[model samples]
Target: MCGVGGIFFKSAEHGAKTGEIAYRILDGIYRRGPDSTGVALWHDNADGLLYVGVNCEAPGGGGRILEALDQLGTVKQATDGDGYIRAAIAYGGSEEDLVDAIDALDPAITVSSVGRHLEVLKHMGGVANLDAKFDLKSYDGRLAMGLTRYATESRIDFTNGQPLSARAVPGLAVMHNGHITNYHHLRSSYALKGYNFSTQNDSEVIPIMLIDEMSKGATFEDALNITVDKLDGCFTYIAVTDDCFAVVKDAYAAKPTVVAENDEFVALSSDPQSLREGVLSDIEVWEPGAGEVHVWQM
Candidate 1:
């Protein structure tokens, strides 16, 4: 089974602590998906213009990415992380425009995440090798989610990894466990509606379908509820947006999930063991009922 886990702070906390905790949570669920790891985080820079996390394949977070984005707008802040470059670009443009421009400059550059408050980092490796490519402990944000991908229906590659953000809207992120039996049917429908897809993984559609509903003016919760009814599968998904964190299960309640929360933090995992490994021993934990929905605002 694939592993999906998330930790959301009720308020913005110290970046280092937040990052460190994210790592711990991933460690708890490491066994669930040892093939690839993905983490998505949200933080605001207090600017009206959206600040994107540029995860380009530039050698040394170099001038190539800067040159490409320079055509769009100024680079306000940039950093060379474990194995990716993170940058904030100032541009009053759509996310598609920014990503397409970067691809034009360097086809190797993958915009892993784009949003005013979101950053996604992932690579083709396991928990044993994750630290070499990413330092999620250094990532800071009000909320975060990580997934360990155990490839089933899709090929094993970095591009197919989970914690996938929507193509049209990058701020929303989804981490799912279990298979989507009707993935092809749903993907076909989205294709007919002109929604482009990047991977064959069943989990990828969760964010795309969820985004489609939100684009139509549905609140995140309402969109999630609608998605549950539309998708036919025994799956569970954890969603994190700029404003809130949520967990929703399929109607059958086939997948496993546990939640633990106190005044300071809220943690979710595919199993109770993960919750124990990720959070303090004193926190109360319980299982969510079938088709249940739980959400906490950041």
Candidate 2:
């Protein structure tokens, strides 16, 4: 089993801290997923720099990455966290080329996200370990999603964690609970089309399929709606783009999903206690109907 949570601030003035709340939510659901935890955050970036998230474990990987990125453009800021590196680069270049260049640095290197407003961070172990390394409490953003993963099929590693993003679709990230029944079939189809997946986990397919649909000119919401029909499984997923936040459940709603909302923000989690613990205490919480989709745009 896995635990997923999302928080979308209704206004920047809400005075909400994304990282602190994300910690509470994931910690509340720690028992459900004690193996690993991750988070994807979106914030306003007026500087026009692309935020690139890469997983690199090679010796001197940080220096190598900076050297390579400087060859293309100026790297404004880059920070290391465990095995991940988040860099802000001012470059007018193809996202594919940037990611490919980074991935070629080492066999262990994988680009998790490249976007204007998105930063994906994950680590094996508990939420505290993740916070110790990335300092999650300092992040203040418009929307963010957190996940605590319990490995069922894939190996328990940094790259196999949730909150996976599509390398081809910048500013898009997904966190899911439950399993995808048609994962292998979908993986084969997408792989045959030259799509590269960084992990063997089934949840990784969610973002890949969404990227495929969005590439065909479907809006983010339309792509998600189409995904609901194409995927055969019992799952509840939350997704975010540059301007939107979405939550979706399978037709049967076999996985648990609870939501809480108020004038300031909206929150979702696999456990209701997580909502109460991370969000508001005296607010009402509800569940979406089977196959239901809820989206909020900024």
Give one clash count per candidate, in the order shown: 1, 0
Model 1 agreement with the true structure over 217-272: per-residue lDDT tens digits: 99888998987898887888898887787899998889888888877778888867
Per-candidate TM-score against the hidden true structure: 0.87, 0.95
lDDT of 2 by residue, 1-298 (tens): 8899967888987787878888888888888889889888886988999888777766568778888888978999887775777788998889989988888988878888888888788887878988898888888877778889988979887777878887556888898888888999999999998889888889889999998998899988888888789899888999988888899999998988899988888988899998788875756989988988888888
Residue 118, model 2: lDDT of: 83
Which 10-residue span in candidate 1 carries the lowest summed lDDT? 53-62
- Report the error of model 1 at residue 13, Å: 4.8
Off by over 4 Å in 2: none
Clashes by residue pair, model 1: 19-137
- Cα RMSDs of all predictions? 2.8, 1.5
